[model samples]
Target: MKIKVLGCSAGIGDSRRTSCCLLDADILLDVGTGAGELSLEGLIGINHVFLTHAHLDHAGLLPLVADAAGRFRDRPVIVHALAETVAALRECMFNWRLWPDYAALPSLERPFLRYEAVEVGATLSLGGRKITPLPARHAVPAVGYWIDSGQASLALSGDTTLCEEFWDALSRIENLKYLLIETAFLNADAALAAVAGHMTADLLAAGLSRLRRPVEVYVTHLEPGWEDRIMAEIGAACAGFDVRRLRQGMEFEF
Candidate 1:
């Protein structure tokens, strides 16, 4: 499986972009402003989107992408998320006032977007990948994804705090090669990170100690301007793992 980091910043400013990832060619993990950087061809090829939560930084471009791709692709974009996350999206984002409900646009029966309310611990097959949604700690309904493509498995800690269930799910995946975890704040903002359900460098180190298997860890979702500080903190705290910051446009084949 090829994973592309379309955007990895916790928030947007300067050169930083919010969370968004492209899995292979057809699947999108989030639709943040980073998605706007994709080529038109990239936009049209996305057949599925698995959102972690309903935060604007994570799902800002969903409706626009569905609408833009509607003209080129005949099929609707399948948006998979937890039930409450879907509800939040409907009530906040897809409401007729904010954007056209593409879930019912073009036609009620055949729309450009569809929502699949995925439950925690449930695994679903999408194309060649098996996706398992895991419970996450956040201000709103959230979930992390465990993706296995028959070769290597990966755990994505969608914006979350140090949660036991998240670690438990990670421990269950065999041959887990990569962990795209989030570190949204610096150590100085530990309190803020906790309240916002985000991980700081120190918090992430504590979480890593619970893992039994060795994995290449790529830290993402950093608040802009503190990337250097957060990266240094992660390196200082965890020396046993190959930990690095995620960069936009970086593509990895695993």
Candidate 2:
């Protein structure tokens, strides 16, 4: 399996793209602004989207992608997300007022998009890979994903704070190679990080201290302007682990 970092910034700015990842070539981790970087052919080839939450940065491009793809093909793009997140998308994003309802476009039976409500802790298989939705702590309903493809597995923390279940679930998986966790703020923003259900350098370090096994940890979703400071702080805090900051266009093959 190959995981490509489309964007890993906390907010959009020059040289910063929102959080999004591509699994192999068919699956998307989140359809954030980074998705806009994909070519028209790449966009049409995407078959499934596993959304982390309903936040605009995490799911902002759904409507546009669906609309563009719908016009070029007859296939439906499956959006797999938590029920609440799915509901929120319909109510806030895909509503006719905000954007045309792709779920009802073309025809009800042959719509351009399909929403699949995934349950936390459940694993679904597709295209020879297993996608497990792990519960995540966020302002909105969210989940981390453990994607297993025969010989290798990768875990993504999505956007979350310290949580026992996330660690416990990861421990149960064998041969886990990489952990794509979030570090949305610097240590100075610890208070804001906590209230926003995001992790800071200090908190992420303390949280990872409990892990029983070590994995290659690549932190993502950092505030663009503080990337260097945040990376240095996280490095100091997680000195014992193989931790690094995720950069756009970086690729991981497992």
Candidate 3:
């Protein structure tokens, strides 16, 4: 499977976009501002979207995508997310006040959007790809994803702090080739990172210490202005590992 990084920044600025990824052509990992760059054909081609959380930066643009391309499709766009995330979006986002209820738009019998609840540890197979939700400790109900394509796997940590459970899962992924984890703040902001359910370079280093897998690591979600400082701290702290900063538009094939 081929995965393209649509967006990877924690905060948006200076041409940066929030978290989002395009898996192959029809599957979207998270629909963020990066999705805004897609052409109409690209938006209409998205058949499924797997969201990490209900955070605006990660999922805020989903409705627009559905609205822009839903009517042209033969069926409703399927959205896979945690039950809590679906609830949050239903109550907060698609309530007709913040945005139109695409889930009920036109008609309930045949709407343009549908939501399916997913849980951690459960793997969903699509054609030749397997996607499994992994545990994540975040400000809201969230999860990382492990996308396995039989031969190799790519794991993504969606806006999470340190969690031994996450590392434990990684160790079990025997074919893990790449790990895209988030380190949203600098070492100096360690206190904020803890409370905000984000990671700092120091915290990420600690998390990495628990991971025994030999997979390549790419740090993501660095704050807009402090990218350099955060990456520098990550480089210093994770000296023993092959860790690199994730960039937008980067693609991976596994």
Candidate 4:
């Protein structure tokens, strides 16, 4: 499987886009402004979307995806997410007030999009790929994902703080090669990070200490202007680990 990073910032800016990534062209990890980079044909090629949560920066552009390519396709774009995430999108984004009810538009039986609730630890196999949802500790109900291609695997910890369950799951993936985790704040903001359910450099160091296995780690969700400062802190704090900043347009094949 080849996973491409579209956007991975905590906030948006002229050059920075929020959390989103494309998995082997057909699956979207999160549909943020980064998805706007795709052309019409590129958008049409997407078949499935696995959301980490319902935050706008993570899932804001999903409506446009359905509107842009839904009519050209024979089937609805399948959205797999937690029941809470599905409910949040339904009540907020796709309820016809904010955006068209694509799930119910054109007719119920032939809608442009569909929702499938996913649970933690439940693995879903599609084609030759296997995807499993992992536990996430956040302000809202959220989840991370473990993508296994049989040869190797990649685990993405979608916006989370210090969660032992997430670390426990990562330790069990024998084939895990890459870990894309979020470190949204700096050590100075440790208190805020705790309240927001995001990770600080200190918190990240604590979480990494729990994982006994070594994997290539890329830290994501850094706020735009403060990236350098936060990373400097992260470098000092997590010097013992292999951690790098996740850049956009980067691709990982496993």
Which is superior by TM-score, 2 or 3? 3
Q: By the lDDT metric, which is better: model 2 or model 3?
A: 3
lDDT of 3: 0.92
> Which residues of candidate 3, in runs, are more than 4 Å off?
none
Model 1, span 107-150: residue lDDT tens = 88788999999999999997778999987898778999988988
lDDT tens digits by residue: candidate 4, 1-254? 89999999988878898888999989999898888888899899999999999998889999998899988998899999999999999999998899988999888998989999999999999898999999999999999999999999999999899999999999999998999999998788888888888998888888889997999999999988999998999899999899999999999999
TM-score of each: 0.97, 0.97, 0.98, 0.98
Error of 4 at 86 (Å): 0.3
Q: lDDT of all predictions, in order shown?
A: 0.88, 0.87, 0.92, 0.92
lDDT for model 4:
0.92
Q: Give the TM-score of candidate 1.
A: 0.97
Q: Write the per-residue lDDT of candidate 2 for residues 1-254, one digit (tens) a residue.
A: 88899988889988789988998888899999999988888888889999999998989988887876777777899999999999999999888899888899888989999999999888999978889999788877789999888787899999998777888888888878889999988888877887798888888887687767778899999877888998899888888889987889999888
Per-structure clash totals for the candidates: 0, 0, 0, 0
lDDT of 3 by residue, 64-102 (tens): 999899878988899999999999999999998998898
The TM-score measured for candidate 2 stands at 0.97
